[model samples]
Target: MSHHMTKNHPDSPNGQDDISKNDSGNPTIHEIIDIRLSRRGLLKGGAGMVAGGFMSMGLSACVSDSSKTATTAKGFSLGFTAVAKSLNDVLSVPTGYTASILYRTGDPINGATPAYVNDGTDTAASFDFRAGDHHDGMAYFGMASGGSGMDLNNSSRGIVCMNHENINQQFLHTAAEAGVGFSTAARVAAQIDKEVNAHGVSVIEISKAGGTFSVNTASTYNRRLTAASDMDIYGPARGDTLMVTSYSNAGQKTRGTLNNCAMGITPWGTYLTCEENWAGYFKRPASGGLSAKMATAQNRYIGSSSSNGSYGWANPTGGDTSGTGLYDRWNINLTGADATADYRYAANTFGWVVEIDPFAPASIPRKRTALGRFGHEGAMPAPAVAGKPVVFYMGDDSRGEYIYKYVSTANWSSADVGGGLAAGNKYLDDGKFYVAKFNSDGSGSWVELNIANPTISGYATYAFANQADVLINCRLAADAVGATPMDRPEWTGVNPSTGDIYITLTNNSDRGKTGTTTGGKSRGLDAANPRYYSDLKGAATQTGNVNGHIIRIRESAKDHSATTFQWDIYLFGAEAGADATNINVSSLTADNDFSSPDGLWFSRAVPGLMWLQTDDGAYTDVTNCMMLAALPGTMGDGAATTITNTAVPANGNANQTVATIAGKKATTDTLRRFLVGPKGCEITGITETPDGQTIFVNIQHPGENTALADVASNTTASFESHWPDGGNARPRSATVVITKNGGGLIGS
Candidate 1:
């Protein structure tokens, strides 16, 4: 999500309110990058150094070490002409590719449901059978040709599980509905019902015929799990007191999952839908006599104690006629006497990685607490090796947060293929969680985040009563263990060809800012987060790492369980014409430059191919968000270098320096723009078929910038974008299928 979209509402779901309180005094990534660059004598030069200095070094192009330099993947080169940047109200793909709308917001997933009316007159109950809004982070599970079960090799038929992260309130309702307290505490019950049912995840069947994919409206597997759905709590914190709520006295169950972002797939054929920015959905006022323990946890995990909650999900009056506390559950204030009396602990039930069995629609989703609670962007599992433990890499999607990995106690086995939730119970219930600690030598270590660690149990900031407490408050433990604070860690993915893990450190506004800690914690540039400058977006001047960067780590000796790993900056997001000395460190050209890298996934069928998506605001003035294809070489492919950052006028107009290990600058042969999304929309959530011939990409929140006043006034000409179904229709978030013109491999 883009911060610029909600600048007026700081408490909005994707806003920067849920920042890190990592005052651990541990060295940040910027400091490590500075140490390494200085040790290699890379920062000795002045600020006038040219970007070509890195290209002249001629680094290795292989994705692995020197021993595997000659074994490049079969399709290592980008084959299509790069799409030019566009501000059009429609998706733009490469010249040889065709993109067709596959699914959209409010589209019916079942044959019995009525077609979407686009005028917002559809019944609130009908959205339960329709596709949710803001399509994001999807995966394809191949279906057997004979309509039996899953078949990994099948490409023509499959089920798509996608996250409907949020809704566009203005567009989803009519003018009269908005005037009836949609944005206030007295929100209309019918409007709130529609909004609540429009969130969470959606699973629909789709098939390919004549090179086009369409939703299978009559498939028995089609279903939508919304914010009001019932789910089971699993793992260490299942019966813990912290999870207790009015709905679940045993704390073993909860209603609904919110803010579902990126997703992952388990070897047992289950979907891992992560919950990001979920804290914003709760209201926790300071007037409630909040205990010190509760306040500490709330201020650290959620932001400010005076929050009114995003969208006022807790405000519908006298609405729970069924005694289910449907609307009251969103209020986390300690109004009642105990945890069982009110929903004070309801927020804790959220923010965990939820596992859903798409194949079995009746199965209940489970919240995997073993993965540690935070604003999880995605949980990317490392390739499951027989007899080895199942491993997953995760990122906390907030500024100055940490990257974490989970190693299940149970080893992987092929026999668990169809085990579903039972397999999830076996492999996801007991796991050793660790957070990354990057060192100045370019090597990193995974620090254990368990209460058993002396640093965690003996901490003075917050008391850990048990393992459940530690898992529930793992961010505090990470701070206690001195984990490295990253630059707004987002989607994480593991390279299929090399077993390397990559995490997108989406831009941080607080980086390199001079002053006492503000907007999370402030610090100067470092090796892993080396770039810091000012960006002019429209009339507003944005500072810090205006254009984010991606960092990758390779486990020692190719072992997923290794505590040590080596890391490097894979690519820096910058405009093609930015200053080459400091900002455009990646040496990107017009054909491949990007900003605020968000969604990332390495192709399972295309060997070393990787897809990079953007959720940008700084660069939106020039172009809409986009997706790019890359044959990214592995870690250590480039040398250490120095970046001399020049502060904007707002930051004192002084120059500062930092050292970083830069990857080999991307070229036209290795990276190119594949698609650009519609105006005011973000290009994210991508997956392809087994044959790599068809790819599904999600366009989130199209026309998101449209003002509520404009929608209320019916000012059609003032709309930012009307995409997918264009002629005067309201813009909608949709999933589109992209394929090569004649059904050859996509991006080839």
Candidate 2:
């Protein structure tokens, strides 16, 4: 989610409030000694290359001049000069590469649809045939030559399935803000319809030719799944009473997905779009008291709120003539006779990993509830080993939330490569769910989140009725099991060679901050979230670990089903010139410094190569958000260390010394900045072609800082940045295709 969307809201300027109360004496990770240590042998050895399943497709003769930076051919190495930190209104890349727009908001999906005007004049009905807004997580599924079925190895033609996380409200309406054009008492029905339609997932066809990629607007597989589309609820939570709503009285279905952030790609050629920040879309009035069970779930997920959702989507009237209350379903209040008579249970149907078949555009999406929903960032699956259960790693994106994983009951089979959602039913529907518990000694264990677990079975705060209840109210179950509360765990990525899981803790301002308590426990300093410092933002000062860090873990015996693992803080994010003793723990230089790591992905074709993306608000004064290329080491590569955290002025706290495990510090060889995005945008959602020569990245919410009042004036000065489609055009969220000038592995 974009922090710029809620910059003026009551919550922190960082998009979410820390809502988890996991104060069980857990430890946070910290670094010490301000060291600049590098193992030159490791970079030359090229270890983990073949192990990561990469074939030596030697560089093409057409390789660009930038590839001359490759010092050795042993393992995967970054081959381009790091792009300098930039504040320009355009995307910047290395000298020998190009970043061109691929698909953009309101781009026509089919030949019948007209080109987007982008003047806040597009009708609501047209959005179903056009591209949605705010593109987030995405996956590219290769299609057969005839555009009929899956072709996992096809590099030239494929289907790009992406998430439209949300809308730039000011640009979507004719009069900028919602209440400007229509009634002051309620939102305009047409504007609300257009906004809702613009939020969901998009499946479009794309082709590559002459070293350039473009959307295939006339392809048959192109389609849009909006907020009004039908979806089937699957897994243990299906048909549960808590899921009943006016739209689905049987509780076996729900309307559509919302706030889709990160993503995952299945071996069977399907897309897993995660639902993050969905709780903030429902309307729950404080005047209407909730049932004890309902109240516990609502408060735990969304916190206590007396107002409508972020956009007040339910404030509009007279749009539900079919008696299903299409506009009214956004409200979660208990009205009318019972659950079936109203949308009180609508919130329970969201917060899941929805499975969609990009190859089969006519199929209905399935909400896989077996994943145990709680602000799902992404559901990244480990490599599917034969005769072993398929394992998927997940992270809850809210502050103080827990990390989760699911192991399937059935063994993996290569024959199911084209199984589509049928493969999902066999693997994702019935699984054993778990939450991670990190220990102070660099070791960790997974706590099974089953209804039969003693801690969950006998909980006193809110009794879980059954397995379904436990899945719906997963945060409560994790709380009961004493899962480790992390620093805003956002994305989980599995190493292609090592079977290790890497998670991004995108900064938690509440970590170790005084006077901030939950469940009678204060969020103090610990090993897993060690830093507690302050940074000045204009006139205001922000505290806590504002720069964030990434942690990695390896399953015991390289088994995804293993309940035990080893973990370490892989890298710390800080400014290049910050205090090296406490803040710049990673020993970063100007070439590779970054803050707020959000989207992370491992290249399938390049083996050990990994890509990192940022959604930052803390470092905007220096540069826009960016993406980086890195070759990481294994767990426990660095020694344990201790650091002292000085208290922020005016914040009530004292200096505290904490010891934590630190991985090998980043170096110019192991990490380097690759691309810097446009102004007021986040660099998220990355995917590469089968050959690893071409890659796609999403730029979300460009020019988002534009004032609503200036939107209707229609001038170039009204926007913070005019990018992708330059000149005086309104800014749009879009996907850019990056490639070496000629033909060579990207970053090679």
TM-score of every model?
0.92, 0.92
In the predicted model 1, the residue pairs found to clash are 30-526, 33-527
The lDDT for every candidate, in the order shown, is 0.81, 0.79
> Where does candidate 2 stray beyond 4 Å?
1-14, 17-74, 176-185
Instruction: Give the number of the best model, judged by lDDT.
Output: 1
lDDT of 1: 0.81
